[model samples]
Target: MNVETQKVKIFMQKHDNQKRALISILQDIQAEFNYLPKEALQDVAKTLEIPLIHIIGVATFYRSFSLEPRGKHQATVCTGTACHVRGGPKILDEFERKLGVEAGHTTEDRQFTLETVACLGCCAIGPVVVVDNEYFAHTSIREVGSILKKYRKKEKDNE
Candidate 1:
């Protein structure tokens, strides 16, 4: 038995294994692993007696779900109309440059995952950045280093 198998067993025990709870099950799996590991998905399919394709479809259909391993910290730059005009693209570029990964890729160290969002409804503070669920309003390219530095320090501390 591997680590993923153990995690799947733990999560499967939380639910009744009914197909109706497929989404819920997937959520639990994602929450546990930060993404859906292929082994975990297989466990889910076997447990629920559902086809792997259906499970994969549900995971892929939801933007909130990540099929790949995600970093410990998630950083999202809002690229909506208001944010774009306010140099959101520049901010995003700064993040990519500092992190050495594209918008949709995680850092090699798995410390951070960078992403862009269409809107966060905080147009009043265009060019917003959300990191690990905390919103940073009125973000600027200059602030990217400081923001990333903070999370990097956090990762080091946890180590």
Candidate 2:
């Protein structure tokens, strides 16, 4: 089997190949690949004896799952009522301008994927920006560049 398929099989094996563990298996696959690859999904469907449509349904049902490849880092801005009133749209616009990509797209360099959440549930800290699970509370347009720089530097250092 190819490397991707092998990885999917391993994830399935980890969950004992039970249908009930489908979500967990898909999570494992996404965590490894940064998205649910078509081949991996097909392998999962065939191995689990589940319909591909059902698998796709489950995958698309979750906002966390992405069929398309995502960037090395995920940057999410809060745009809920509280955040929106607190310059959240401006913050998102700054990010889009800095990253040269829209909110729902990944950068050309594949370093970051920009997204927006309705609410981060931290209303007191309105206008929150999260990068790779690190929450930046009370974010502002001015802070956007530094946030992108921080992640970009990490990518460079890793290289």
Clashes of each: 0, 0
- Model 2 stretches with alpha carbons more than 4 Å out: none
TM-score attained by model 2:
0.94
Candidate 2 lDDT trough over 10 residues, lowest sum? 1-10
lDDT of 2 by residue, 30-49 (tens): 99999999999999999999
User: Stretches of candidate 1 above 4 Å error?
Assistant: none
TM-score of each: 0.94, 0.94
Predicted structure with the largest lDDT when compared to the true one? 2
Deviation (Å) of 153 in candidate 1: 1.8
C-alpha RMSD for every candidate: 1.3, 1.3
Model 1 residue 20 CA deviation in Å: 0.8
RMSD of 1: 1.3
